[model samples]
Target: MSGPIRLWVAVKHGVDVVLARADRSTGTVAMDRAPRKTSDFDRNAVEEAVRIREKLGGTVTALTVGPPTSKEALRDALALGADEAVLITDPARPDLDGRGVARALAAYARTHPGFDLWFFGEGSTDHFTGTIGPRVAAEIGAPSLSYARRVSVEDGAVLVEREYEHELEKVRAAFPAIITVGQEINQPRVPTFMSTLKASKKEIRSFGPSELGVQPSDWAPLARRDRVFVPEVNRKRQAVSGADPATTARGLVDALRREGVLP
Candidate 1:
């Protein structure tokens, strides 16, 4: 709180799903050939970090563990208000699994103790696994705060609120903790043209696992995807016909009951 706090946030550069195709034969989606942009939810993460920096004196550094294109996501974060950015890339495995991504981030954490706060969206806009924050917490040996809807800094600690069923749960942890925030935490502000231009000059640092003294054997994927396929839909299109509206309504009700649509 005394000195400028270093804030690190994860940004996801994702492709537009409009071109998403499920290969029935391969049982996988064609991802490499799709258009990309900064994920919608990740913008909220950067927004929250910028908000914290605005209220409290600090600097925000955007972090992304992704392919080379992920720099677009980091630039988006910078324009929104991050002071700097870091890109962790592995050409061998461009699309890293959740645990692998967490390991890389944790390795970065080991080298960069200057980060007082690290932020992530509850889940990426594409894959909503909701596990990276906890995984990073385990890798870095820091406390994990998940599903945060409301957040604040108090006495050099992060105070968080999250939804639990019909109620809201509150929790807090000291600085240098990992927090995964839900989209409800804050509304993202649109960066002005001037701010966008200023962001272009901010430094975007790059790193690889080797630089952190991390060996390929050091990080293993916690999970892997076999394939992705769209399930076939079966629908019964039946019509209820009658001379009057009330009769048609009754007929529809009968048809629903007969089909077991209503119990």
Candidate 2:
């Protein structure tokens, strides 16, 4: 293999299997909860990058921006066959939105040049904001394509296909472009026991805003959260007492009609 490509795969660690809360007072979504694995779409992105690297003979570097506890996602990436992992942790950036996170990642990418491609998921499962990859690419002045369902490289160029509401689109772009993979892009591979153990021992590079040459003043608020609150669970059950089956049936129909379940 010749002309080995350097691939950077972005992953995210979000709240564990719990419903996201929107702060009603501050409009900020609260993320201070137990950390979980990488986003499902992001796992596909990492797996796609790893597969590309395996075919093209290159290095796959997994990068994530989150709290210190986000290292778990990096370890999982390593277990999935990434060559290296980088975790960007900044206490001041605890509530970073897509734009802020993109700025940081763009700066990191600028510092480490010679990467042939940048890969990310279409969106994070928790936030569901499909903006980071495009934002990072714009900040770095690189061309980008999002929602890619299939991708292949040929003659130093990338061929990709994506779906629109009513159309299927195909794109061919040069190297050093950013691409966001959708769930349909590829199925993520499960890690073996040995791979898991090896990933646990892998060295993860950590950085902060200062290390990335980003000042607090340089950061701009792209999105704002007003408050965070758990949604109230409604589990009221109604019981109807009836003496006959016909009466019970009539009651049930009445209840369904009242709830607009039937006309």
Candidate 3:
């Protein structure tokens, strides 16, 4: 492991989509204001990347695509252990779909050839499509390992243990590969006050689509979300009451029998 393994990690800024509460009529989250944090799954991938960089002796780069709010993700990555960070955003302020994101990342990969390994969470919390890793690999023409629980470098190759069917399987691939990690991979490290303070000074480079060799058409989403809505519960609610506990119990049993709950 004399030569460091250049690691690249893709991270997503955290927001609780469910907690925002969707309006079925509008197909949008009623998020007047929502607390945001880094997703646990993405954090796991970041942690693994740092650990691999430390063991194999390589620089770790955290990359993300979003608006100004996404800077938090880059800083968080730096605090957690990434040597550097990159933020890719749009000047016009538009949303990118999964395919668009993969394309942009692929263009980035082509522009930056130093990274020997790329890491991602099994799925993003906001969009659990689980398609980004494979899509990026396809775009970049690299080997990929999905659902990896553990990863290591050995004998000039990357070794990974991943879930296969009902059991785990061991697989190996040459360098310059992609890995999408599951939550079982490893626990992410919490940054201390010192680390947080130090991370503030780390370099955080910003890039636009042009800088990454990405075109508007290349980054345009394949599909757009038309709307969001919660499904109707379509059920009835009833209450059974009694003056005493014994009476309540009897009434409950009688009601269950009447409703054909008891066989």
Candidate 4:
């Protein structure tokens, strides 16, 4: 690009999946029971954006939509290399669906024009919906590439490779577009002690829907959680004991057949 590109990366804070709990009684996923952190895929997206800024000479802005507590994710992004962070939070926005999140992001993009690129993870690790990037792009009337496993920028055009069920799909699109990166893109760099210290002092901008001229009625219905429950595990096994090699071989074959490993 001729001018300095302003890159924006969208991230989300979710319950650490390792510690998340499903409240069967209330049929809701409870994040309060577990510690929270930035979504893993989003971290990769941030890393990719950072790399792009470093190579192309630009600024990286990390954006997130969530409750006030989501500032933690923003701070983490700052520690990772984002130049600035923005958090869109409001109580009325509770349970904001993919469309609502996209609308908010589109509003932000409209307010801050001239951004050469926008980046996002292929999908949040927790939800795995993988729809926000395209939805946001549609709302903003911008081009977008999703599930990009590899990416390159050259002479104002962006090239990307997306993973398909049985093949790799390639695409070339101009800048001022949105791209959602897959985990295969690159490993996220860990924050150094110095970076963390600096991030502590970095200012994070916060805003509400009203500031973006968004109305609650404009948002689509939030996704509902009818019920949440831990899955039950069942296992059956039988030991075949024998001293003769031939007998053991025959027994093993029978066991395999019984288990449907062989027909």
lDDT of 2 by residue, 1-263 (tens): 13788888999986655555556666555566544667889889989999988887889999998787888889889999998999887787665677778887987987877778889999988778898999898899999999999999887789999999999999999988999999999999999999999999999998888888888655566677654556565866888657898898899899889989999
Clash count in backbone of candidate 4: 0
Residue 113, model 4: Cα distance from true site in angstroms: 1.6
Task: Tell me the spans in candidate 1 whose CA falls farther than 4 Å from its real position.
Answer: 23-27, 220-222, 235-263
Reference-based TM-score of each model:
0.84, 0.83, 0.85, 0.87
> Per-candidate RMSD vs. true structure?
3.2, 3.8, 3.2, 3.2
Q: Which residue pairs of candidate 3 clash?
A: 4-57, 24-229, 27-228
- State the TM-score for model 4: 0.87
The residue pairs in collision within model 4 are none
Candidate 4 lDDT, 156-183, residue by residue in tens? 8889889988988899899888999988
Per-residue C-alpha lDDT of model 3 across residues 1-263, encoded as one tens digit per residue:
33667889998875676576765566566432454556668888889999987776788999987776878888889999999998888867445778877887788888888678799988988668999899999998899999999898876678999987898889999888999998999989999998899888887888888898767777776786764456667765778789999999999899889989897
Give the best candidate by lDDT. Answer: 4
Q: Write down the lDDT of every candidate, Cα atoms only.
A: 0.83, 0.84, 0.82, 0.85
Ranking by TM-score: 4, 3, 1, 2
Best by TM-score: 4
Error of 3 at 223 (Å): 0.5
In candidate 1, position 133 carries an lDDT of: 82
Instruction: Give the per-residue lDDT digits (tens) of candidate 1, residues 1-263.
Output: 55877788988887666667777676567677667778787888899889988988788889998888889898899999988899998877787888788888889888887777788888876777788888899987899888888888887788988997898788888888888887788889999998899888888888887887788666666676765566766877767789999999999999889889898
